[model samples]
Each structure stands twice: as C-alpha cells, then as structure tokens.
Target: SDGTSLEGNVVLPDGKEVDAGEVQEPISDEVYYIAPDKCTECMGFHEEPQCAAVCPVDCCVPDDDHVETEEALLAKQRFMHPE
Candidate 1:
C-alpha cells in the first residue's frame, strides 16, 4: 500500500473502540463524506465544530462553495439536534 489513506484508528462517542478499518470499505470510498450534511463550519469558529475539534488528523475543512445561510445552519443544527 504505497499510496493508501490513513486507517486503523477511531474513538466512538460512547468511549468505545472499534477496529473499523479491518471491516471497512475500499480506499476509493474511504475518505468520503458530505459537506452540508456532515459539517456546519462552526458558524463563528469560536465554538469549534465538535467534528473538527476532535478529528485527530484535522482532515476536516470548510466548504466555502457549500456555504449555508444562517437560517440554513440553524435548520441543520435543529434537524440534527431535534427538540
């Protein structure tokens, strides 16, 4: 694996560990995720997005092209947070 993506490490929200890499998908689909659906850009960047703050590798990056309006961000947060 001369040109392989990072693998073999993860910490779950419940503090459990998993050997996901051993049973994961192919490399082409390894480093994969959606912008609007996966991240919110921390709005003002002070309260850093939990995902970005905890990403051990810092692979997370803002998607300017997928910028969401204030209303949109809130809607997303509420959608994910629920009442």
Candidate 2:
C-alpha cells in the first residue's frame, strides 16, 4: 500500500501559525509525531480516538503515563477548537 501523508499548519490559541515540526519532533522522513499538548484523544470530536481507529499498524495507543480525565480532555479540545 502507498503510505498516506498529513499536511497542516499548527495554529495556536493566540492565532499564530507554526510549522508542524515546531510542535513535534520528526522521528524520521516517513514517520509522524503527535504533539501531546495538542492531542485530546479525539474527546470532543468522536467517541474514540480516530487515530487509534484508523492507524494501519495500531500505533496510536494511549500514553499510559500521560493519562487525562474525560473532563480535562474535553476542556482541552474546546480550548484548541473553539466555536
């Protein structure tokens, strides 16, 4: 299968746009990194994390060491994606 690619700007709450590389370290040319502070585990958008659901290799598992409550996750989601 041909690998998929992701492209987007990392916009902050302050309205500044940043490069994806600024927020997440590049693991390699093919691998992507998720920024923990920007991740809400898809709390507000879906019942479960879509990343985990669609990951071809099942590498989007939760970080046990950085567990967060549902309320905290939702709050973060709202903060990042205000309507």
Candidate 3:
C-alpha cells in the first residue's frame, strides 16, 4: 500500500470548506459511510473510483445511500478544488 490518500478541503452544501478528515463516519458496524459531499468518486482524476480500481481485494464499493448524478459529482469536483 502507498499509505497515501487524497487530501484536500471539501466544500459543504452551504459553501463552507472543511478538511477532508472532518467528514462524519458511519456509526454502525454494517454501514461504511463515505461522505458524499466530499466524494467526487474520482470525477476529476479518473472515469472510475480509483480506490476500487486499485484495491487488492476490491473492497471499496460504491455507497448506495450516497448515490449522486454525474452533474453533482462534477460540481463537487469544481467546488472543492476550484481553479
């Protein structure tokens, strides 16, 4: 493992910036929540989720509860890392 992960500020729905680590985690043992607001789902980096692509066991699966459209994903990408 590279021991590296994408680190950047995430824009909240209200336009506030929060550290990536500040995202809330799942409370249940059965639920692994990835912050939808923070997850661009590799929108800016690749066509697919990079973590899932590179996982040795492919354990990184999409969060069904956090379903987002492409437009939403792209908008998030721009919001979090404006150029």
**Evaluated with TM-score, which candidate comes out highest?**
3
Residue 78 of model 1 has an lDDT of 49
Could you say which candidate leads in lDDT? 3
- For candidate 3, the per-residue lDDT at 36 reads 60
Ranking by lDDT: 3, 2, 1
List model 2 lDDT by residue over 1-83, tens digit each. 01112235655544667664444445577866665666778887898888888889988756687788888888777765656
lDDT of 1 by residue, 1-83 (tens): 11123245544333555553554344366674544443445543347677777789988776767877777766545433445
Cα TM-score per model: 0.44, 0.60, 0.60
Model 3 C-alpha RMSD vs. true structure (Å) is 5.5
Better model by TM-score, 1 or 2?
2
The list of candidate 3 runs beyond 4 A from truth reads: 1-11, 14-33
Better of 1 and 3 by lDDT: 3
Query: Which stretches of candidate 1 lie above 4 Å from their native place?
Result: 1-28, 41-46
As a whole number from 0 to 100, the lDDT of residue 77 in candidate 3 is 76
lDDT (CA) for every model shown? 0.52, 0.65, 0.66
Q: Which prediction has more favorable lDDT, 1 or 2?
A: 2
